[model samples]
Target: MEKILVVEDDKDIRDILKIYLKTGFFEIWEAENGKQAFEVLENKEPDLVILDLMLPDINGLDICKNIRIKYKYPIIMITAKTSDQDKIAGLTYGADDYITKPFNPLEVLARVKAQLRRYKEYWKGSNEKNTIYYKGLILDRNSMHVNLNGINLKLTPTEFKLLEILLLNKGQVLSGEKLFHLLREDEYYSKSTNTITVHIRNLREKMKESFERPEYIKTVWGVGYIIED
Candidate 1:
C-alpha cells in the first residue's frame, strides 16, 4: 500500500480530503501543522505528501525546502493563494505540483495519480531502450541512475526524468512544448510550457550548471531548448 501524508491546519478540510482519498491501496496520515508534518516525515517516509500553504507552525514553503534537503518524494501544495508568484514560489521551493483552494477532489486525485505514475516510470527506468549520455554524464535506463563526472549524483525523480530527456537528445534542440509533452506523457500530468521551464531550471541548479551559459541545456532563442553535446 502506498502511504500518503496530508498536512493542513483546517480540520474540516483535512478531514474531507482524508475521507475522499481513503482507499484500500492507500494508507493515509494526517498532520495539522508544519511541525507535526515534519515529525511524520521523519518518523515515516510517505510515498507522497499533500501539503497546505497556510500552516500554524511553519509555512508550506519552508516545509518544502526542508523536505527537499534529504528526501525527493513528490509533494503537492494546496493553498488558497493563486497568484503566479505564490505558485512559482512553491515550485521553486521544491513542490512537485500546486493546487488552489476550492479545488475539486476529483482533480486532486487525478493529479496525485499522475504524479505517482510519473515518479514510478522515471524511478524504475521504464523504457529499456532509452539510455542517454552527455560529456561523461550517463543516465542508465535500467538503473534509473545518473552518473556525472564518473560520480553518481542522487537525483529526485523529476530531476532524473528531465536530465534523461535532455541527455538522450544531446545537440538536438527541444522546444518547451516538446519537453512538456515528454514529461506529460511520462507522468500523465497536464501543465503549461512555463511549468516545464521551471522544472528544467530546477534541474540545472541541481547539476550546478550556469543558466547564463548552460553547457548541457541551451535556449534556441524563440524555439525552446536543446542539449549541447
Candidate 2:
C-alpha cells in the first residue's frame, strides 16, 4: 500500500482527506502542523506528501526546501495563495504540483495520483537505464543526483528534469515543442512561448557548455536540440 502524509492546520481538512483517500490500497497519515509533519516524515516515510502552505509553525516553503534537500519524494503543495508568483515559488522550491484552498477534494485526489505516477516513472528510469553517461558526466535519477568527474552539479528541480529528458533521449533530436509539453505537461504553455530556450540555456550554462559551440546539448540548427551519442 502506498502511504500518503497530509499536513494541514485544520482538523476538519485533515479528516476530510483521510476519509476520501484511505482506501484499502492506500494508507493515510496526518499531521496538524509542520513540526508534527516533520516528525511523521522522519518515522513513517510517506510515498507522497500533501503539504499546506499556511502552516502555523514553520513555513510550508521551509518544509518543501527541507524535503528537497534530503529526499526527492514528490510534494503537492496546497495553499490559498493562488497567484502565479506563489505557484512559481512552490515549483522553484521543488514542489511537483500545487493546489489552492477551497478546491474540490476530487481534484486534489487526481493531482495526488498524477504526481505519484510521474514520481514512479522518474525513479524507474534509473532501474531500467541505470546511470546515463555522457562525456565525463554521470546522471543517477534514483538518487536524484548528478555529477561530472565526481563533482556534483548543483541543479534546481527544473534544471534536473530538463537534463533528465535530454539525457533520456540522447542522440535523438527533441523539438522544443515536445520538451515544453513534456516538462510542463498540459499546463499553461503556448506555441509562442520560448520557455524551453531559456531552460536549455540555463542547463548548458551549468554544464559549462553553450549552444554556439556545444559539448552537451547541441541545437540542431532548425531541428531543435539533441545530445550526441
Per-model TM-score on C-alpha atoms: 0.87, 0.73
Q: Model 1 — TM-score against the truth?
A: 0.87
Model 1: colliding residue pairs = none
lDDT of 2: 0.78
lDDT of 1 by residue, 1-229 (tens): 7888999999998877877777436778999998899889878999889999989889999998888888877899999997888988888888888889998877777777777877776555353565666787788866667787877776656667777887777778888888877865744444456777777777777677897897777888899888876
lDDT of each: 0.80, 0.78
Highest-TM-score candidate: 1
Steric clashes per prediction: 0, 0
Reference-based lDDT, residue 140, model 1: 80
Give the least accurate 10-residue stretch of model 1, judged by summed lDDT. 183-192
The runs of at least 3 residues in candidate 1 whose Cα sits more than 4 Å from the true structure, single-residue gaps closed, are: 125-131, 141-144, 150-154, 186-191
